[model samples]
Target: MREIKVQLYRGEDDNYVELWKTVEKIEGKHRYYGRYTYGNEGTWYSVCDPLGYCELNAPMADDVMFICCDENGNEAIRYSNADGNKLPKFETVIKREWNKAKEKLQHNTEDLTKNFWAECWNGDTTMKINQWLLSYKDPDLYPEKANDYDENWTGCWAEKEIGYEPIPDTEFEYLGHKYQFTKVKHKHEYCGIEWYEFVCTDSPYVMRDTPWVNDRAWIQSYMYLGNWFDDKTYGTMYDQRSAREKVVAALIKKFPMKNKWDKLLYVKKKTGNEFYNCDCCYEKSYSDMADVLINRNYHRKDVDYLCKFINKETEGIVFASNRGNKYTIRQTYPDIYDYDNCLI
Candidate 1:
């Protein structure tokens, strides 16, 4: 443990030292364990990092406590001039400053939560939340570091302060549909697994709204392979899946394998794999058996059902699984696109 010192100042009218911190260890970390600042005379000092969520001009106001260190950071006298200052107990001042910072952080979090819900719902989502913190004038919130704020910070704040990512109302034209996705900033978006809005190019205005879907196939077919919205902004990453793969996933999700023809069902009925062979294919588990069946062309009937769904919904979207469920997009690369084994 390195020797360090703490100081309390009025930090209101002027930067006058009010008290010296005689004790150490408030909550297990250094008193100034957040950020650093460069001084006018060339020096480095600690600043509360989370205090960035609070205003520096707060009444009674910001950082009355500061961390002071020397060039070699040698042990320093705890209370050099306490008798002259007639200061309160070291904990008293520390708690006072600490409590204020906590209350301010809580207040900011509540404020952020209120503002986000108000704009997200009410049918007027502009999806321009990157500038949500910019409306309030400075000296109130991060006035000193306002220029450094942007979508990156906004996203980070939402996760930390707001506790959820804001899902913007995004739309796109692909796979013969004009789709849109909207949600309360704190909710999760989808990929046939999460949640989103999907509609064809000619969808009626009345049919344009976020829907609660139970099946991945229904939503994944309409979502971006990754997504138009930056997942990083929400403290999340969008999945990378091919459109054809998504279609196949949907088909497989829709497939009925209750019959004996499916290897899983065959194993269930026989209840023994000692010397069993799914046409010279042997597996001890259902997952392994399924992969063997699909990759080895044991799913000929499955292809028919899958390709039918793609053709009817996407119109000429030839689904191919030659490359392990991920097929080529015919419109973009026809020469390499092959559906001969698709059986549809």
Candidate 2:
């Protein structure tokens, strides 16, 4: 069996530390495996065969210990301040940072929720004012009549004075386009009678006014006039404006333009991997799976879905696996069984 050993050495400048690895052969000769140079700036450059070299920035205490694993990735040894003193493990540093980030994210989410409701609904904000301006209730089709009416309620139940002239089976210019308005008869269940309503057949957009309550009501009225207004419907103005604001807020949260957590959250969501500290390994695994899917002629969307599924389903297994073990779909998922079978 192969054996590996790790050693820490002070750099030539004495300002940094070099972490070196050596693999022992059957003949007892040691070969260089990799090295990482850690400096005071909280960044390190890792150089290994095949994978080449890369820089990693991790927030770690200066006195933290570097835990070295065996060839099988078992914690076999640890290096502290060179005096055999107790120190925090490498994972401890990563876990602390992750926890801090999670707390910040939770606080930001709460703030965002509160701001959305306050600025969009409760306050006299632009969105709230716009909603108020757009709010409308359809003219009461059936007004209640009072037995004895006062001067204040004289016209409360009077028939509507304003009438809409029918411009039927003709084309009219609206928003720089000619649209045909057709006169259609609709039947109401309550009245058991038919009424004539005019509708624009080919228009730029659905008209919200006239015989319909809202855009949805106007669109559905073609099938049946009973759909002109639903009893459960919120006022058209409030519903439409509220819906727009909600969509805007959702989009902002999903893809934050300026926040630092935006990129982190996006990567986590896309890869479906929670171990952000292992992004390099996660990316390599994701690429390998993508290549396999591409070779099978799977669509891009399908490949993305399969990668997400594999990452999610194998998350626990990957976490429990040996640190150095390559977390591949074949090794983690049940469908692939083995490296030779690429069923997924």
Candidate 3:
């Protein structure tokens, strides 16, 4: 027999009251069923029914006091809100009771590993290695073994099958900053060939400030093992270059220089002359060609000369000579000609 503390409250009262009850083990299960109520004055009292007995399947009232406990009344499982307090949270108490009923009889790692692999594949190598290592030791006695086993089990497994060899640490500069090589992983892709994956320790400032680049961007800049050898001559040349040189070349190729004039040309071709004109003139134009050209950063002497040159080179290019309005060119013919058609 063991005593367990439970909290219960009356329907009309907001305060919870604590109760202690003794439970007896019968046929490997705790059994206790009794109904006790306080009098109208709400005074506490005790009732003992020595001959009364009930099965575990009996319906319990909403305010019944119960806690999850083993046969000896020791707390078998920790509840999220138990906190060793008299009044445990309502939801935590319910969860504790539910878990006590649905507890697993044994731990099965095979099923758990299969489920984990099915969901995420072997991408989570850390979890797979930890689970595999735990199977070799008694978790209860050697609880700290999992924390101490920090070997790269995945790399060891790959090395056995692929004959993969790790490269020593190397330092290189990228984008005006230095980075240090950390580790490598090689996987067998063909009968006699293996592909390598490199990991580098990137600077914190570079990782945070760079807009589109991440830590893995350095490795991805280089071609994959299979593709690296596709160009026979270039591959031979690449093999000859030092590691630092190869990394520098990959980084340079990844972010190629852009020609400012070429970018301007591309914008002009895509958006047409209106965009170029507006861009160069700051979107400000007059009604006359002379005034428009003058406002567009052309000198006073060169404005007339350029206007005349443009009028000869383009069709329907004529200057409006109206004094009431600003002088500008009419590139298209209107139904009525309201301005003097000056050749320039």
Write down the TM-score for model 2: 0.15
How does each model score on lDDT?
0.29, 0.32, 0.29
Of candidate 3, the 10-residue stretch with the lowest lDDT total is: 260-269
Top model by TM-score, which number? 1
Structural similarity to truth (TM-score) of each candidate: 0.16, 0.15, 0.14
Candidate 2 colliding pairs: none
lDDT of 1 at 158: 26
Highest lDDT, which number?
Answer: 2
Clashing pairs in 3: 287-328, 288-327, 288-328, 289-327, 289-328, 289-329
Whose lDDT is higher: candidate 1's or candidate 2's?
2
Error of 3 at 80 (Å): 16
Q: Please write out the lDDT profile of model 2 over residues 1-344, one tens digit for every residue.
A: 22234433222223233344443343685333222333223232334441233222342343544455444444555544333433232323333333443332211112334435755653322322123222331123222422222111211121121223233334433212344433444433222232343333443324334344222233211211011222243332232334334333433443243542321111112254544423222222322322322343222343444444544533433321222333343344333222222122
Candidate 1 overall Cα lDDT vs. reference? 0.29
How big is the positional error of residue 277 in model 1, measured in Å on the Cα after superposition? 12
